[model samples]
Target chain A: MTKRITKEFADLQTEPPEDMKVDLITENDLFKWVVTINGPKDTPYAGGLFLVHVILPNEYPFKPPVINWKTKIYHPNVTNDGKGTMCLGFLRDGEWKPSSRMAAALEYVRQLMIEPVPDDAVDPAIAEEYKNNRKQFFKTAKQWTTTYAKP
Target chain B: MAYTEEELAQYERLSNDYVPDAEGPLVSPRQSSQRITSEYAQADPVYVHKTTTLPQQFSQYRTVKGDGNCGWRALAFGYFEALLQTADPSRVLGEVARLTSLNNVLDSVGYPRDIYEDFTDETLQLLKSTAATLPVHDDGAALLASFNDSGICNAIIMHFRLVTSAWMKTHADSYVHYTENQSIQDYCSTHIEPHAVEIDNLGLQACIDAIIKPAGIAVQVLYLDRSPGEEVNQLNWPAGPSTLNAPYNGLSTIRLLYRPGHYDILYKHEDIDILPAAAVTNPQINLMSGPVYLSSSNVCYSQQGLDIDNFYIPGLMSAGVSLAYSTDAYISNAIYAPSALPITSAATDPYSVPYSEPPKAIVESPTLEGPWNTDRFRPSQYQVEVKFRQVMPVRPEPCQTEAMKQAGESKAHFRNEDFQPQIWEPGAEYNVGRNSEPNRRRSS
Candidate 1:
């Protein structure tokens, strides 16, 4: 397992995704990863940095990693509570295949920032507001990004 | 009732997060397929009609859990089983060599060598190790043990998932039509690669093509649905044997009992010799689990349940029940006859209401087989626990054991062995001394 994990870690460090920087949370443990994803351009939260916690279960690769947004965001797919839990459709337990790549999962998270999946959202009310009232939703999202996600 | 926004989001989260709590072994011990017959006896008439005819063609089955990965697990277990059955180490070497060559496919299919090394290495190790233990005639026990261990089993199955994925990607033309609207690559990702998604027909076909066919193993899926039929619908890939030469001792085929959403391995008596260690410790598959093993035991534990269950043996009507008893295999299979009786005379309506008239089939005369020309159905003292009064036709009690003793005690020499004879031999020699006969032990 460490072989697979450290190999994945080495690959992530050497050639990280264009929008994301991934590193082990500490030098000692490989299970916890600290990730920083740049909000996509043209989106309301553009230029804002997002810190996400990626915790790989002991059954890594077999079981999926758990992700929580340490940096709050006003996206319908991400919960607005302090926990900020995010469940991308593919990352859900049933949908996560052992062959599913972490890089590809993060890409899905990145894509969600550009186009929130209002239909499959974690915060239904926020999703409703985003779908029915886009301009007002963008104003609050940008303000939240400025208040909470700015570096 | 409409849910509030908070409730709605919770519902969405719960649904997405829901993973079933899968029970039973990853791959279970092989069992009498008749357990399946008895399991469906009480269901609608169509199912009763189909499952009753199942064991006539397929005698045994090993259940793979209904867990999401059962399809992949079943195929993987079946492949290893076929290898072990080959009893030829070179088959393992050939598979290892073939799989190593498939590395070219895995790499070209866009999987990095590094990411897949763990799965590939694990798969190769098991194949090599299991074949090494062949001389012991472990009867696939070593293979079954490795499969039961989640760490080993999951890695091997993951290797299978990858091979299936890579196979589909490289050979897109044959599979392109089956992928529906999705590309072969995407279809493989969601269907073949996932640890949790059950295999659909295409995935079963691809895995069989990539791994099984090359090893010369046939795969048949018996669909046990309510489709109009006396038997389950069989789907065998490489319908006739493929170009790959059939191994001398290699499997005839790996049978899967596909009950719509799930897949379990089925074994014909012939398929089982190549599959599992004959019968292991689980005595539960006998009387406790279901009526499948109602094959033996005239000692009825439940006189009441006997009458009800006996009504459902559709196979009894196939050939005359008396005619069925003539076949030794059918006697043990009495096909779900827990409270089963051997009618001295064939009753026109054996399906008469349960517990009525003590169910006329129990032949009360000194011999149940007296009426039939075949002595195959003779009830002995061994089958005579008084608990079976209803099944034995209220025989005169004392004379029963005296006659049964000659039949039972003649061979009942091993005092310390199990109380019940492993396999009863009726009218075996009471004493075969040097003067009487020569010793002929069945030495393995």
Candidate 2:
């Protein structure tokens, strides 16, 4: 498992995916990683960075990494407060494939920003807002991104 | 989908109230499949009908816990078991090379050696150890123990997942028809490669094509469902590779009883038929080893009344219990080709109840109520002719010569209060000579 993690960590560092930066939290703890996804261009949340926290369980590749949003954003799929933990379909239990790579998972996380699936949202209020009122949704999302996501 | 706070609380309560689908060993020890029949004995009519007929074909089954890995575990266990049944050390020994070579398929599909080799090595090591117990005479204790160990079992299952995934990917054209809606790679990634996802039909077929079929193991799944049928419908994959001359090889089949969402291993009586050297291992009567035995198609030979610890197979022991089929059929065919009795003809009140119709031919005088009522019939060309009347124990006559006893049970031994002295009862409904000829049997 350590060998697998080391290989994954090295790959993430040398050939990182676009719009994402990943680093181990501490040299002592390989399981805890700090990741940042660049908010996509032309979206209301553009030009801001969003920090994501990831904790890989020892069973890893066999299990999925535990992830939460550290940066507050007005996204329907992510929780509005607390740990900001959320679902991305594939990362959920019973759906996570052991063969899935962390790189591909992060890539999926990046795509989540491009297209927030309001249909499967963690925040019903924002999900409803995103669906029912697009103009107000963009304004509030841009405001929150500017306030909490500027680094 | 998101839920309101109240809905979330209710959902939480519901989730808390729910228990898991299946819980037990990843794979369990073998058990009498008759237990399966009685399990559904009180269930819906369909289940009762299907399960009652289950023991007719499959005599035993080993449960695989319903933890969503049943299908994979059943086939994997079956593969190892088939290797044991093939009984050739070379065949069991030969699998390591065949399995290791399949790593090439894993490689071609880009499953990195690091991720998959750990599982592959575990698989190979298990096979090597299993092969060490060459000419497996005892019923697979070592194999069962290995599978019960979660770590070893999970690794083997994981290795199977990898192999199946790779098999489906490289053999894309073979499976493209099944995955027309999505790319084969997409289907493999989500369904075939998932550790938790239970195996679906396509995945099962790919796994068989990849590992089982090439190894000369026939696999079957008995779908015990609510579909219209007197017995469980079955899908069969006949014995692998025409070159592997395993004729009349019942043990090679990995019969799985699929009940909706679960899969359990099923075994024929032949599976429990111990090798001569290991006859003492099983406590059950060694029917095959016995010099004279009686069986009847009319009677449902059920072990339902067994005292788990001290139970004898019905016909082999003294007949304290009486069971009869509706029609007088070949006594041997019931034991030999148990599947021959169509569920339609065999009345639903199986096991203990007497069929409404009288037997076409009676082995013992139909009116015989005497202590020793068994008949001494002539042996068929294939085997000895003896019909089971377990209620009365067959006693050898003191005056009979040794040669007379071997050729046929001494006619003196079969006599009762009403035993007719004549060999052929002229114009009688029960003809002794015709009944003795097993090759020609009445349909009803």
Candidate 3:
């Protein structure tokens, strides 16, 4: 398990995903990581840097890692509460495979921001507004990004 | 958060179902027969049929827990068990060398040494120490305890998984067709290399062929499934050089019972009995020969129940009896001439005589002719007489000649080109060459 974690960590450092930066929470603890993703251009959350907490389990590859958004933003897939869990399909228990890499997983999260899935949403109200009132949803999403995701 | 009832239920089931406990025993003892009986006793017709045949076919089965790793666990347990059977330190040492060399395979596949080195080391260390203590009979319990250790067991399983997966990747063309047209890389990433993923048949075959068979060990997988068959299906690993050819010589067999989604170690009643020194001299011949009778015993009863008297070929029956008592020596002699046909009729006609009367025809025919005559002085002639009297009941003969003809034709078909032994070359279209573009994609 440590071997897998070390390999993933090295890979992450050497060729980190575009516009994303990851740091270990502490030198001794390889299990927890602080990741920041700069919202893609052309999206409402553009110019915002979103913080995500990555917690890998002891059985690193066998078990899927837990990723939570530490910075709040209006989105259909991310929960609005303090525990902003993202509901990505691949992270689901049955769908997750040990061969899935951290870089690929993080890239998937970035892609989700470009086009959020409303059917499988963590926040139904946001999903409904995004579906029924697209302009208003973008306005509120931009406002929240400015208020909470600055820097 | 919003989820449909079905999604919620699925999530609940996934969280509640068994997650393979790493600390659990690597291999558990054979559960009671009642465990299988209870599951199938009143269930589907297919299961009931399987339950009925299970007892006669297998004396007992030791299970590997339903952890997604059961396939790897079962194979590893089988490997150690085969080694223990040899009780030869040299063989264990040989295995250690073989495993060490296999690291090259992982390297060829671009698996970093740093990632898998510790696990491989743990496996090789265990083998080295086990070999140091030869005639591992006394230390059997301790050895099993070591296997139960989570770190050691998981490492060994992972090593085997990598070896199997590497073999598949290297020889991709042979297996890609079976993966529903998926490319070899896609198949390996999804099924073979993934941790906690259950192995499919192709992966199992690759493991047996690349790892176990090369170690000179044969595995007999008893498939207990819902297929419409009176007896369980038996597949020998490394599948013969050709389906018609016999398994590699001098290879000890490890029997595994395969259920729908799980694998367990199978034990024959004789496996439990302590063998005499003489019996141990040639264990392979003894083990392969026993299952033939065990499988046939059920077939005999079932055929009788179905009232299929004509299905019995006296010649084949006599050959089976002779092969059983005298071993392969009789088979070499019997293969020479088509004399078994005359012997079959001459042998089967005596059941009409009273038990008090000696089988005069059988005795007279063999003694009247000289040893040089093909009809006389065959070992099968004597064994068949004895076996026929003891086990065979009187039944009307079918067209024995026609049956023999069909059997001969089937044997010829097995020798056809389609059944030829497959040889995998590294640069073949199906195989992933070291310098191939796909190889570049794999590393990336």
Best by TM-score: 1
Highest DockQ scorer: 1
lDDT by residue (tens digit), candidate 3, B1-444: 898754664475456444655544667765555466567789878778876777765676676766777888888877776665544444555567677788899999987687677668777777655544333133245456767777677677778878888888898878888988788777876777766778789988888877787667778888878888766788876422311112234335678878888887876654443211111323233333211111111112222222122322322222232233234322211121122222334435553332231122211111111111222223344444443335532232221222222332332333334444334444544445556653433233
Model 3: C-alpha RMSD to truth?
22.7
Best of the candidates, lDDT: 1
Q: What is the lDDT of residue A105 in candidate 2?
A: 88
What TM-score does structure 2 among the candidates reach? 0.65
- Fnat per candidate: 0.73, 0.43, 0.19
Q: Tens digits of per-residue lDDT for model 2 on B99-196?
A: 88899998998887877877787787867565443332235777888888866777788899999989988888999899758899899877878776
User: Which parts of model 1 are misplaced by more than 4 Å?
Assistant: B238-251, B274-444
RMSD of 1: 18.9
Task: Spell out the clash pairs found in candidate 3.
Answer: B173-B430
Give all candidates' CA lDDT scores: 0.66, 0.65, 0.61
User: Candidate order by TM-score, highest to lowest?
Assistant: 1, 2, 3
Off by over 4 Å in 2: A23-30, A38-49, A131-135, B1-21, B136-138, B242-251, B274-444
Candidate 3 — which residues are off by over 4 angstroms? A3-17, A40-43, A74-77, A87-141, B1-26, B31-35, B44-49, B138-143, B238-251, B274-444
True lDDT of residue B352, candidate 2? 27
Using all chains and alpha carbons, the TM-scores for the candidates as numbered come to: 0.68, 0.65, 0.61
Q: Give the Å shift of residue A40 in candidate 2.
A: 4.6
Error of 1 at B1 (Å): 4.8
